[model samples]
Target: MYVYDEYDQRIIEDRVKQYRDQTRRYLAGELSEEEFRPLRLQNGLYVQRYAPMLRVCVPYGLMSSRQLRKMAHIARQYDKGYAHISTRQNVQFNWPALEEVPDILAELAEVQMHAIQTSGNCIRNVTTDQFAGVAPDEVIDPRPWCEIVRQWATFHPEFAYLPRKFKIAINGAQSDRAAIEVHDIGLEPVQNAAGELGFRVLVGGGLGRTPIVGAFINEYLPWQHLLTYLEAILRVYNRYGRRDNKYKARIKILVKALTPAVFAEKVNAEWAHLKDGPSTLTVDEVHRVADHFVDPAYQALQDQSALLAEQQAEHPGFARWMARNVNGHKKPGYAAVTLSLKATGYAPGDITDKQLDAVAELADRFSFGEVRSSHEQNLILADVEQTQLLALWNELRELGFATPNIGLLTDIICCPGGDFCSLANAKSIPVAEAIQRRFDDLDYLFDLGDIDLNISGCMNACGHHHVGHIGILGVDKKGEEFYQVSLGGSASRDASLGQILGPSFAQDDMPDVISKIINVFVEQRHADERFIDTFRRIGMAPFKERVYAANH
Candidate 1:
C-alpha cells in the first residue's frame, strides 16, 4: 500500500529501460546465454524447460485492486491465461516469451510493481503475515518494516550478488505465521523488561538440502539500529559465506560451520562498524512508512454472530465454508476470508485471468480495494464485513474459489514441479491432485482437522514440504519418479523439520501412502488434537510402520 514517490518511480522506470536494452542485446546475439544468465535472473526471468517464466514481486503480499487488475491483464496479454501464486506470496507466469519480458516489466512498473529481487542471490521480496494489520493477536503492524526493507534492499550495490539467495521475514504477532525460523533473517518485535520496543533477530535459518532452524543472534536489537544491524549481518555473510559449492553457499551452512556463538560474535563485531551509521532507522521515517498502512474507513457495527449463526443454520454448505475459510478480524463485525485456490484437479495456486479480475472486483466491493496473497497459495480479502459473508461465499463458490478446505488435508501447498520447473526431478501438481481427489469428503477432512500437506518436486523446498504436517518430496529413482514422505514438520511457533518415513514410493502409490499415514494419526490421536500435535506426542514410529508395512 506504500505509494511510490518520484525517486521510486524514476528508479523502476530506469531499470525497465536498462533491462529492455539487455534483452534486445541478448536476443540479437550480442550477448550469449552464459553472459545473459545473471542479467535475466536479476530481472526475474528464467528459461525453464519449455518456455521462460517471469516471477513478479508482490511486496509483502499486499496488492491494491488496481495492481491485481494489471497483473490479470499481463497474464491475459503477455503469456498464458493464468498465473501461479508462489509460496513466498509472489506471482509467476510460466509461459512468457523471453523477448517480451521487458515489456511485461515496464507494464508492472506502471503499477508500482516489479520483478526485481524476486530471483537472484540478493535479498528476495520481504514477506510478512498476510493478516498483518488486521490480526487480533498482532503486537505491531509489520508492513511498515517490510516496506522499509524492500526499499533498502532493492538493487543495493553492496549486496547485488551474494553467495546465494537471501530471504528475510518479519513477524509482529503472537503467532508466527510468517515462518520466521525458516528464513535467512527473521525479525520478531519484542519488548525488553524496561518496556523498550526492539527486535529479536534470528539468523541463518533455512530449508533446502540441509534444513536448520535459525539461531537467536541477538536477544534484542533496538528499533533505531534495525537497518544498521541488518547491514552488519549481510556484510558478514557476503564476506564469509561459501562460494565454492552452490549447495552449501547459503548462510545457514556458514552459520553451522562457524558455530552459532562464533557467528553471533562475528556479527556483533561487524555491527560495531555500522552502529550509528546513516542507515540507522529514525523515528520519523518509521512513522512515515507506517502511516501508509493505517486502518481503512471502517463503519461501526455490532458483531454479527447471531446473524451468522442464522445463516449457518439455513445453509449447511455455507456453514462448512465459514468454519474453514473465514478467520477472526481485529475489527468488530469484519472477517478475513481465505479464498481457497487449491481446488481439486487444478494445480494449487493457479488462478486464471478471469478469476483474478473477479477477485479484484470482489476486493473493491468488500475488502477496501485491496487483496492479499497468503503463503499457503490462497488469496485473502482481509476486511470483508460479516454482514456480507453469505453473499461473498456464494459468489466465490460460483467462481470456483470456495473449496472450504483452508488448513484441511485437501488445502495442499505445492509448487509447479517438473511440469514447469527444470530443476524439479518429478511432478508435483499431479501428486497434489491425486491426494485432493482421494480426500474429497468434507466430513472426513474436517475430522482430520488442520493438516498441512505440502509437496515439492525436488529438494529446493519451494513447496515448503519440510514444514508441512505431512511433507512429500519427489525423488528420481533410476530415471523414474518416486515420492518420499515425511511427518511431524511445522512452520508455526514450534517449528521443526519433518523426518522421512522410509524409502520412496512410486508416483501411483502416493495416495495409498498418505492414506496409511492418516490412518495412523486417526488411530493414535487424542481428543481435539491436530495432526501436528499428534505427531509430536507419538513421534513418527507409528506412521512409519503403517506406511512401510504396506510397501513390504
Candidate 2:
C-alpha cells in the first residue's frame, strides 16, 4: 500500500502522455507493427492470439480498494467485463482494443498504477509474499524491501532491455511462500548470528524451457549493499549475456554456462566498483519505504475459536472453507482469507468486473480498505477478524468464490494457454476445467491434500508447471495438442523441478491420466501423508505404471 509521491505521479503521467502519442502514431500508420512493437511492449500491451492483452502492474500484488475499483471501471468500459490475475500477480485484460490501450493506461495512471516494466526484456514486478506483513511465521515484513527494490528497478535506464524478461522475488517468511527460487533473482532476508539483517541472494533460477532452482550466489549480502549488488549482477548480465539467440539470452542460461561460482566472482568483482554507491539504500530510506506499510488498527479482541467452532459444528460447509481458505495471521483474533478463483467452471484466474467491484467493497468492510492478490491467482483479505469469518464466507459463497479446495487437487494453477496465448501449443483452460470437474468430490479432494496441479499451455512455464506436485505441459504433436505430465516438483523452501512421466496424452484423455496418477498415490500413501509426500516416498514409477499400463 505504498502511496505515490509527486515524483512517482509525474513519472507515470508523463509515460502515459508519451504512450498516447505512440499509440496515435501506430493507429495513423505513421509507425508500423515492427516500429511499434517495443513501444507497445514497454507499456505492457501485447498483441495476443485474438486481441490485444494489457498487463497492469500491481506492485508486490498489493492493491487498494480504490485501485481495485479503478480496474473494474477499466474492465467495464475499455476491455472485456473481466480480468485475469497472472501467476506473477499482475492483472491482465484479455480483450482490449489496440486504440484504447493508451486510454486504459491513462486511467491506470490516475490510481498510481502503470504497465511499465510489466512486459519486454526489463525488470518485471518485484514480487513478495502476498501475506508479507501479516504471516505468523514472518521473519521480517518484505513489503518495504520489495518497495525499495521496485523504486530502484522501475525505469532504470541500464536494464531497460535485457536479453530476456527478468523477474525478482523476495521472501521473508519461513514458509517461502514467494517461490523465490524460481525467479531470476531471489532475495531471502536472513538474520545473522550478529543480529544484522541481510539478504541471502540466489541467482539463475527460472522455469522456462530449462528449469533450474536458483543457486546461492551471495550467502549474505548486507542490507546497505542490496542495490549496488543488484546493479553489479545486471551489469554483468548486460555485458556478456547472449544477444545472438533469444532462447539462450536469459541470465539463468548465462549463469549455467559460466557456472554459479564464476558468475558470483564476476558479480563480486563488478560490485567492487559500485559498492556503497549513490544508489545504496540508507537506513532512513528503508524506514521511509517501511512507513508506507504500517499495520492496520487491529482490535484487542480475544480469539474467536469457540464462536468459530460453534459455527463450524452448525455448518459443515463453513468448516470446510475454514479448513482450506483461511490462514493464520500474526495477530490474534484475525486471519487472512483467500477467495477461491478456481471455482471449477470459470477460467482459473478470471474475475468478472462485478466481482472486482464487490471485492473492493468487501476489502473496505473487512480488510482495512486493501486486498492482496496471491501468486495462486486468488484474492485475499489479509486482516479479517475471525469473528466475522462466517459473514465473509457467506458473501464469498454468493460470489462463487467459497470453494473449499485450496491446496487440494481441485485448486489448480492453469495458464491461459492456446485459448489466449499465441505461444501456447495447446489449450489449458479447458484442460483445467476438465480436471476440476473430474475432481469435484470434495471429500475425495480433501483426502488428496495439498496437491499443486499446474497446467501450462507451453514451456514458457507461465503456469509454473515445473513446480507443481503434478505438472501438466501442453505439447504439439502433428498439429494436434497433447499433454505431458511431470511429478514431484515443488517451489517451496525445499525447491526442486519435476520429472516427466513418459509419453504425452491427448486432451480428452487428460482427466483419466490425472485420475490414474492420483490412484497410485492414494494406494501407496501412509497415514496423514499428502500427495507430494506420497509421491516422494514411493517415487514416480508406480504412478507412471498406473497411467500408462493399458497402452503397454
Write candidate 1's Cα lDDT for 1-552 as tens digits. 899999999999999999999999998999999999999999999888899999999999999999999989999999789999999999999999998899999999999999988898999999999999999999999999999998889888999999999999999899999999999999999999999999999998999899998888898999999999999999999999999999999999999999989999999999999999999998899999998998999999789999999999999999999999999999999999999999999999999999999999999999999999989999999999999999999999999999999999989999899999999999999999999999999999999999999999999999999999999999999999999998989999868999998899999999998999899999999997999999999988888888888455
Question: Residue 245 lDDT in model 1?
Answer: 96
lDDT of 2 by residue, 393-449 (tens): 999999998999988888889999999999999999999999999989999888778
**What TM-score would every model get versus the actual structure?**
0.99, 0.99
Q: Which parts of model 1 have CA positions greater than 4 angstroms off?
A: none
lDDT, each prediction: 0.94, 0.93
- Candidate 1 clash pair list: none
On a 0 to 100 scale, what is the lDDT of residue 202 in model 1? 94
